[model samples]
Target: MDYESLYKLIPKEPKKWLTQDVISWLQFIGLGQMEQKFVECSIDGAVLEDLTEKDLDEELGITQRIIKRKLLNWVNHGLKEYNEYIKQMKMPNLNNKKQQDEDFTIQKNIANSQFEQMLIENHENNGNDQFTSSVVRQEEQAIKQEIPGFNKFEHQLILQPIEGQQSNFYCVREAGAKIGRHSSNQILILEENISRFHAEIIFQDSMFALKDIGSTTGTFIKILKSLTLIQGMLIELGSNQFSVQKLDLLDNGGIEISLFVVEGPNLEDTIIFQLNKDKPSVALGRKSTVDISFPEDHHLSNQHAKFYLVDQTVTIEDHGSTNGSWMRLSGEGKMSNLFYLDPNEEIIIRIGTTNQYICQQNKMKVNEISGENLCIICVERERDCLILPCKHNATCLKCSKNLALCPFCRVKIQETIRIYKN
Candidate 1:
């Protein structure tokens, strides 16, 4: 679950929350790693509401002073909000007073609540339309308030004109939405590259999740933490994409996978690693020292993410990146993607401009890398030339002199830059 999703759930009230809800809240406060202790202590929502800072160290065994303070602050702030909400909730005095405004803002806030209320009322009043038009208008006046640019059709695909495409922001809906290029779809894109029924984003249990239908281009999302690694599957780090170049069996019965820089600037120089029991991980980022680097792709952090080759399994994890790392998702079988939107950030289901990349992998005249840090052509000498425009460095100065295409991403080499390193 995305941490911010928990904030939307605060409307459910703390006392009525379950164990998973408490766990979700822990992630919201960035203390999800220590939740086993919370589970061991059987700290449900009711108990969590009363938990004080002292109880963290004394009862939950969270010894780190800073962590305890952070958790304490989150708990206290949340309780304060809940308490204030309860105090303001006025119950009608048995027909002796006017009906109160339901204190809805105290819960999901007026924006989210009213939107949902409109949907629910629309659905409920479908057949039985007894209310007058004036009554409906009056009801809207009392409850309807839209945040400007807020409800610009969360999932509806706007007609795109020729030129370039822009980012699509979706509204969190109770009815959920179907996304695709089909004219009949709830969310539609005109890109011919996108499949007719590309994917679906559903809202369940007060959170949103994305699932691929049967799209050809595929849906991809960044790894917030870990993913069961698969060979051939593409991983998007920033402006580029990658896949398995080589997979080797380790002495410890685990497996090591070397990533093929499919499309991007190679800043790490090489993306080769020996993953034995001693080194069960491979790191990737824009930092030169990273196992696989794309130094020019500022969207990445020093260490964007990691690939863990365990004894029986392989997994990938996000190492606190700026733009985040992504993994391509396969079409419908399992839920595939559970998107817990952080109410703090915009919710984007990025199918991208599908047609532009539909033939990307197929058309690549791949000059696959021989090993990490080696020349793209000779596979022996150091790759030392920085191809201009793309900022890619995958070919040795000797090999790149006559090269027309930058070996990493196949972008035409316009100019060359070579800095000798001792």
Candidate 2:
């Protein structure tokens, strides 16, 4: 009647572990339903009749042999995966130069196929060929991309106030988040106070913008890390959505602040959305979602490629971290270790040391934005210019002074190169 040992046998960390117990549990009871009941029953104990294997197979109309085989296969696979995880943990720390190289080789060999599958999936979702017609737009907007290790979901804030208690809610962009205004570094303005409020914010997909609505006491804005205030007056994000702030008018009025949680899709989902907009098919960097029937090991290291479709042109930039990123333009086979990317261009990101793990990317045309030929970066209009170091393109005078890098690709430049047209 003691299932504690069986539960303890399940590894704490199983990134690559199989879900045999989960499957068996599902068969005995049901998914999402009766989970607590089954856990209680398992604690008391599980009976063959209580397992519901036959009934489940009948409901699913599956043969008894298939269910039994699948269950057995999952158990075996789970054991193997758990053992591998243990083996990895027991290995010596790979830190020294030589050890690092060896670790990179080993890890890459193990993680390569998964990486390549991600790339292939990315390419299938978004290909570079789609950008053949559109010129790169100078006007800037926030877009999302699938970054590894980072959370790719949106978060919202929910505020609740206790009745008759007064509470104040102050909302600003988190620390480390950059802020800019009309080509100038400015502070965000706040609307006066209110009693209760709720607002939504997001950081995934490379977007770097925020908005505040009219509130009772007013909301203040500042950069995430620095004390630098964003320039200009306060502006709400969307036409319809309003920023919120709370003010205590009477007694016992306080609010509970909660964040909106957007659950991420399974690794099997090829295209990950950064915002609430339409999404394109994107390839995985080093992982792919295959038909569940096929073993995951089959497509592990071979498919590490990616691609995305955008309104005008696509851009890629190196994050200026430890490992250097590389690219293969148009499948040329020769990889270039440089920064920045454009439409129709294919790239491979060399992550970590020695470039053992590579993430490839291409462009696709399915979700093309309207107005491919329209170029927004010019000197004439009331355009906002983003300044950079090398001075490749001359952006609007307003836009240039506010940015520290080329807004198109975020490439850092040394000098403030300002080239205006006559």
lDDT against the true structure, per candidate, is 0.56, 0.27
lDDT of 2 by residue, 1-422 (tens): 12332233332232221223343445432243434543432211112223345533543343557555554443446434545665664567757443354323432432343244445555676856533211122111112112232212222111111111222111111221211221222221122222123111233333322222222222222111111111111211111111112111222222211111111122122221221114322322223362111124322222222222233222122211111122211111222222222212221221111112111111111112322111223223432222322223324455456446553334554334322111
Q: Given candidate 2, what's the lDDT at residue 237?
A: 15
Clash totals in order: 4, 76
Q: Report how far off residue 374 is in candidate 1 (Å).
A: 64
The segments of candidate 2 whose C-alpha lies over 4 angstroms from its true place after superposition are: 1-60, 64-67, 76-80, 83-92, 95-422
Model 1 clash pairs are: 154-170, 154-171, 209-339, 270-373
Error of 2 at 7 (Å): 22
Worst 10 residues of 2 by lDDT: 222-231
lDDT of 1 at 288: 99
